[model samples]
Target: MMIDGWAVNALPGVLVVPAVAAALLAILPNYRATARLNVMATTLTLICALSLFFGKPQPGPYLLVDDLNGTFIVLTTFVGFTTSIFSASYIGHELEIGRLTPAAVRFYHTMYQMLMFAMNLALVANNIGLMWVAIELATLTTVLMVGIYRTHEALEAAWKYFILGSVGIALALFGTILVYVAARPVVGEGVDAMVWSVLVTRAGAFDPALLDVAFVFLLLGYGTKVGLALLHAWLPDAHAEGPTPISAVLSGLLLNVALYALLRFKMLLAANPAAIAPGPLMVTLGLLSLVFAAFMLYRRRDIKRLFAYSSIEHMGIITFAFGMGGPLANFAGLLHMTMHSLTKSAIFFAVGHVAQVKGTQRIADMGGLTETHPVLGWSLILGVVAIAGLPPLGIFMSEFLVVSSTFAREPPLAILLVAGILIGVAGLFLRLNSIAFGEPRGPAAKAQASYVPMFSHLALVLVAGIYMPPALVVWFQNVAGLLG
Candidate 1:
């Protein structure tokens, strides 16, 4: 690939802008100015990401771009931009109510930009070691923000996330080293073996045994961050205790970044005919997470935690779709990933507004939302319905594709997947009815949130379901083929 002049400059800007904004935000002191800067920086980054579609820098030892990651780059930056908008309004409320001090607000904005920078770096990275470093940077930034409240529960959640995230990072590092070792014989020693473009092109010649062991480590390691069932202990607490903006970004963008790393490896393994098939492991793990999260959903008392489990379930669906490894399944997986990101973040935006108005995160305390706060209530209802995979919504279309593709490939597994989806629907609607339609409970002060960001996401998702652009379908199809 040849580098265009515009892409050479633009690609670096995607990473540089957020980092510069973070440094400036740390010393700014004024909440309003810092917040606007956050939005502006994210907007610029999103523009850079979109520009990659027209032109891209040449692949290098440390950085690369392709159809697969190009899509992720756009999705990550777009969500980051909208979430920053939502965060500005959301955090301002916290400052008003004394939930956050000005210093904490500065710290939060700085970390937010840092997180965006890290995720953007991770998506664009070509070297396995560089990618690992980027992911760890993101984890640390989020850990700090998760505990920003300084409450006992917030601190504990941060601690748990830190410990689990450290273990995952360590395992991922080991896996990356093993991969370098595996590729060293074919690609030679040092950086050449670590570059993703080189590794995928040469994977078929590498030793199968080393690749197999390395993949096991990689999947378990990154899957932890992806919130696969047993490794998801930290997720609910992190979502429940953190500022809702962090929760939104965690579910929307961060998990997708981790999964993107795993998918890159999956492609490498798939290229090697001698290597063990990667699908079975991902399929098993995905199903386990989907079913486990679905059953767990009924038990969540915290509203944030409820949606957090929903994120896990949807991730499992995406994983399962990709693991199925066909044109249809891969397309579905891509669509599902995009839909879940938008819908889940929109849900958190609504939930944040609701928490602000009601002054609580407890679901038991929130009832009859339609009566007291119709906009928030109805918005939440639409978000919940879309997430539950109701028809004429983005999730419904993506999930339908997943299920239909699964049935064509394996009937028994399709049944299990459907069962999980239906169970999740029941649990969500049960909660939704109480929250949106019953007698009004708790204080119902009118929310002062910027409804634009939340509704904007929901509107996009709705339009996507009704009709996907031909260009997007072709793009997803090409990437799907690349996965196999």
Candidate 2:
């Protein structure tokens, strides 16, 4: 149960080691060596992550590895590994295209590892303050990567991401302090006051007023980072302008991590019977983002931006499921989160290839993809189908559960949910059909792409949809119960 003097705290240290090595490797003058080192380091991190899964849950004041975070740790590492592989090819092309210099690529690789570290730290941290710090670290790392291209547009996107992300994290920290203030009265001041387990156990005794105010700030703060609309101004630009691998990581991993932090606070609020209901706020925002992004999807001119909007829409659905706060709803939320992460990343992977092959990011210029690159086109089609919530894909299963749960509790909201899904489905299919079935529109495509990561993600999404292993269901069920 214990690997270090800290007793069972070893998992966290294992997570931190790669990030630390990555930081050290960042300063190396050799780009070739750094790139290979980056890949090797990420591979090692993935191995450690897999090893961590077999260990028993380690509960403590600073860190823990229960079923809830254990699943996330695996998901994070899996996505990280895939993204790193994709990045190697994508970045190589960028270098050839002169889109990135050797120095910038070095910085990108360095920041990439730092981002991985921050995400892992956020997932494992048991203390609220430390969790906030981890989220901030992740935000900073991504901001640098967002602007790596040094284009006018890229710089603008990075600047906006930095400003908005900083504001969001600041508000999150403020919220964290308020939670501590509320908890101090119940758990007493000092480290225990900010310990997640301690706060959850003593939540009922904390002042409801303080918890209410704190949740409001926390929701807006983390919701911004979660890419919820109204406050989601930063997300599309970040996704569209940034490198596609970073786009995949942002959509597939970082947003979920921010939302996880928000859900943890939501759970604390749930434990406090006297506190104001967090459901209405989450439901309202979820509905807003879903509705907003559904309409916005139709108007996207850029391929990447179009999929970025889809990410926003899917995040909204997950939020709505969690807001419903029933056993089935929460379970659906957990499943939706996983599916969206995999499906969205796959979509971006396909997008990256398409953009590179066609030599344009514009949606209008790229048509009849199937005629040119059948494999990439089919992959894109599969990805869009899975993401559009079509049947037999994991997303459809999750969306169905969400709608069914909403129908049981709130039929009117269920109607809205269906409407959003239908809109998204139509938009995606229309766009996909145009892109995949028409004549080849641009220069003949000819670049070898490692399709394993994209296809592999879609395959898993398919398997999870038709037949979720019982053990996985039990795992999510336990985590969902704990979340509430």
Candidate 3:
């Protein structure tokens, strides 16, 4: 690789390679060829993201990575790679059912790569403007993918997503500009005003009022995209109408990316003592989403929509954990975010297979998964346990930490949190009992389902719950300290 003089801290091939590869995928003649290329590109991208762990931290004018985003980079790429593998089987079935066309398949594969690139760029970005642009690019790509089927409902969902997302992105940009203006008085103009390292170093000297106002817009803007309640109208419809794999990515990956963007700004606020407290604001929004989504879960008719509410609920919990702003709570929040991403996406993988086999996504129409398909049945049951915060799963570990910490600090709120968890558990078990235990209601339609990826994820979640690695503990400890 020839490095430009300006690219002194150039990565060997991380960004440029996958970007160019996405364009290559767009013109591939056949679906088979394109799928192979997509997998290769995703795998290579994962390698690049992992390599960044050892790559030199380049705190420059536009892009850099230290401990802060390195973890997110790994999480994003790992999930991206797994989702692409799942999409391989899932998309073929959609095409056979005439839900998508060859052209659409080409578009989907190409967009998937672009989304991957944008997410990676966002994680590594030093400039706040570049980070915002990368996230917006990712949002647009997913919006296109969501409505790829071009159904009436899909089109409606896409339009709604576009409108709401546009507003949110605009607000975020405005907040970003405010931050730039805040920094310019101290750091002077040029790229320095937008660079995260420079901003953090000078944040203490910036105007408190500017930081306060900027955080509100940033929270509301990115918070909208994070699918918190009140602003979450776009979420369920998107999940219900889009392809299942895309639903998994939107819920698992996209939400995390948005939350990450919020945390970056929150760190800036944390650096300024005179700035308004960011904690209570996040705590309030988090609690609202938790309560709102919990009640909403019991009313969901569509299977995908049911899990969509669950995603909202989990995101709220993670946000609340972070909002508490202690080392233990922050660490728990980080763990929960990672675990939820894995478990939620795994559930969707099962849902996709079940939906394809049964030819329906209604909860009422599906029953007796054990009799019809033991593999999927078991997968769904395990996923429910994992997500509902049952023991011996990663989510359980994180929730335990949150509950214990909250009990010490605020017992009443902890009780409320537990109530939410219990209600979610009952709903999931009720749904699982009907779907996995009863006699098979739908046709016993077999699929070329790949259990390797699904089970692999659950197994990892299971292991993480029982025993988190020491290295991971250290990593989260470092990050949790940074969150303060």
Give TM-scores for every candidate, taking all chains together and pairing residue i with residue i. Answer: 0.99, 0.96, 0.96
Once fitted onto the true fold, the runs of candidate 1 whose alpha carbons sit more than 4 angstroms away are 1-3
Answer with 1 or 2, whichever has the higher lDDT: 1
What are the lDDT figures for the candidates, one per model? 0.94, 0.88, 0.86
TM-score of candidate 3 to 2 decimals: 0.96
lDDT of 3 by residue, 107-211 (tens): 999888888888888877889999999999988998998899898989999989989988999999999999998999999989888998889888999999999
Every model's Cα RMSD, please? 1.2, 1.8, 2.3
- For residues 365-397, could you state the per-residue lDDT of candidate 2 as single tens digits? 888888788899889998998999888999999
TM match of model 1 to true structure? 0.99
Per-residue lDDT value at 95 in model 3: 80
Error in Å for residue 231 of model 3: 0.9
Give one clash count per candidate, in the order shown.
0, 1, 0
Between candidates 2 and 3, the lDDT winner: 2
Q: Which one wins by lDDT: 1 or 3? A: 1
How much is 129 displaced in model 3, in angstroms? 0.7
